[model samples]
Target: MFSPEGPTLRELAVQALSSVEHGYDLLAPKFDHTPFRTPDTVLESVAKALGPLGPFEDGLDLCCGTGAGTDVLAGLCHRSVTGVDFSAGMLDVARRRATGPVERVPAGPGTPGVAWVRGDARALPFTAAFDLVVSFGAFGHFLPRELPGLFTQVHSVLRPGGRFAFPVLAPPRPASPAFWMLLGFDAVMRVRNAVWRPPFVMYYRAFRLGQVLEELTRAGFTVDLRALPEFGRRDGGSPRARLVVARRPDGATPPPAA
Candidate 1:
């Protein structure tokens, strides 16, 4: 799953031992070469699904590590594109990638330049700024209990009617080897967090689709799910990956805070 260009096992071990922020900073340089980076195929497939939804004015790629989704935003958004992440090291790589040889779908000559911002996803700095917001491969970093606040943050930054979107892969069946692997990974992380200081907060099996949809609704988003056909389907005919598109209602006010 990882190339020679990716971090070595020793490097990964050291990073995993660090705090989440510091660990990502350490991993930032070699992130793209790792399997942890979102694949081009997934990005392309998502962009295609979101194509009709756009001609968006402004966009944000939340928790944009090394800016994979930012490229998608640059393609779909006409006014401006910004990627926000907490890790400055990751932001540095993202900024460098902006000038690299990667070809992107043009948002037209009228499109403003792309920008990278360093910020926390739990408390975004922007307010009613972006027409579109997308995150990829970063949800597991957030605990289930944090979903409400995280969704609220996403809701707050979006203009009324603006969409907060991300892709969700269907969980592997309980009997599947992939499922057992993820389950074991989470069990290991639980034990690790119990013993380790400055715990590394990634878990493969923590983010559940049902809970996520429920939390999005509680956060005042009108949610919808669209299947990405490119990844094909299971025996039950459900698509392998689904795009969770949640829109903040136009001109609607957020509910009273506790």
Candidate 2:
């Protein structure tokens, strides 16, 4: 589901052969054209859902590739917005396309500012710097074992009462072709990692909802799930998508070392 201007098959091959950082660097220019970039619809829906929750002061867009979610942060946060990603190329693109004048109406405004930083999610550069943090479509890059550390880092950067929120879509059913497609992708990734160096860890099936919630709780967040009703329920009445809001309790101490 790529646009006409997206990366070619050759480019994809080259990227897949490289390390995750290098691969994302190579793909940065064409990332927005690909389906890998979070869609405006989903971002808008999330913004709408979080609209009532905010009036947040400072915001951070974690793993903010090419700054898609940064816009959402700008809309939700009052003071300022910052986007952080590991890929320098992605940060470059984000700065180049940065929004200068802030729009005011619903979310209140005073010259919306944007900043891009190159950093690792597991070791954030800030401590209690943001009132809210939101990530989009970046969890697949992290392995299951890395979740606790990653969540802890996010927790460390958030002020008390601050939230670490993101959207979680339900996995496709085993009977569905989409499920098989993802399964095949994960299978290929496993084999690739076994034989490759500097492995690129991206598996759609690795991040389970139950495990994620428990980890958030372990990280000292008060967790809650809000169904995104824009995308309707499934056949069994399960929500098609959900927004997970993990808030660090007000006045909670620093995240314990893992």
Candidate 3:
């Protein structure tokens, strides 16, 4: 739908009607041609911002579709980088990307190893494995109620003092066309889910920054915001896009208090 190489309109329609996992499988091959892939500018900005914070041993690209964020990690982390997602089709594309033209990041002295694994974000499959985890453009697939468990899963995989980071654009002003467009999109998605079996849970307005920060805090991470200088700023002086860097504290997971 985004380019000649992208999915056709009829193909997008078929994908939208299918389950999220299968829909992505359908979209995987052409995802890079669509606007859905994180832009190179954003990835470069993230790589620059993360450069000073690193020397991280192992990193992860949570929900890494096509390895855009994985490449960012390859440049930033010193040891190894992993990209995990639920769609095998997406993973296939990501694996291909790892072997293709590599994105070079001069974060430091060493080149990080890259790997791809297919897995779900809600129930991640690692423990104390990563020092930095970053995701892009996948939060909308998750419902609001699932934030806690999702963040908890990110928390579980990150080593003590590890960071879970993602760039979030500032919500559009209420009077802006972007805001109304998002509202309309969410409304349509709501109606679609109401009548459709095995509802596709994507919603544009569901992931509020306030609620997300609260969940990140509750997930036992101390969170901070870093400005992404490339996107510039709003009239109000807030960054156009800010990177949320949530750090898992250095301690053992506590037992449930009986």
Runs in model 1 lying further than 4 Å from the true structure: 100-108, 256-258
Candidate of highest lDDT: 2
C-alpha lDDT (0 to 100) for residue 106 of candidate 2: 30
- lDDT at residue 253 of model 1 (Cα atoms): 66
- Tens digit per residue, CA lDDT, model 1, 17-126: 88899999999999999989998999999999999987688899999999999989878888788889999999989988785323223435765568788899988898
- Between prediction 2 and prediction 3, the one with superior lDDT is 2
- Measured on C-alpha atoms, candidate 2 has an lDDT of 0.90
TM-score of each model, paired residue for residue: 0.95, 0.96, 0.93
How far does residue 9 in candidate 3 sit from its true spot (Å)?
Answer: 0.7
The 10-residue segment with the lowest total lDDT in model 2: 100-109
Q: How far is 1's C-alpha from truth in model 3 (Å)?
A: 7.2
| lDDT of prediction 3 | 0.86
lDDT of 3 by residue, 63-87 (tens): 9988898888878788778889999
Off by over 4 Å in 2: 101-109
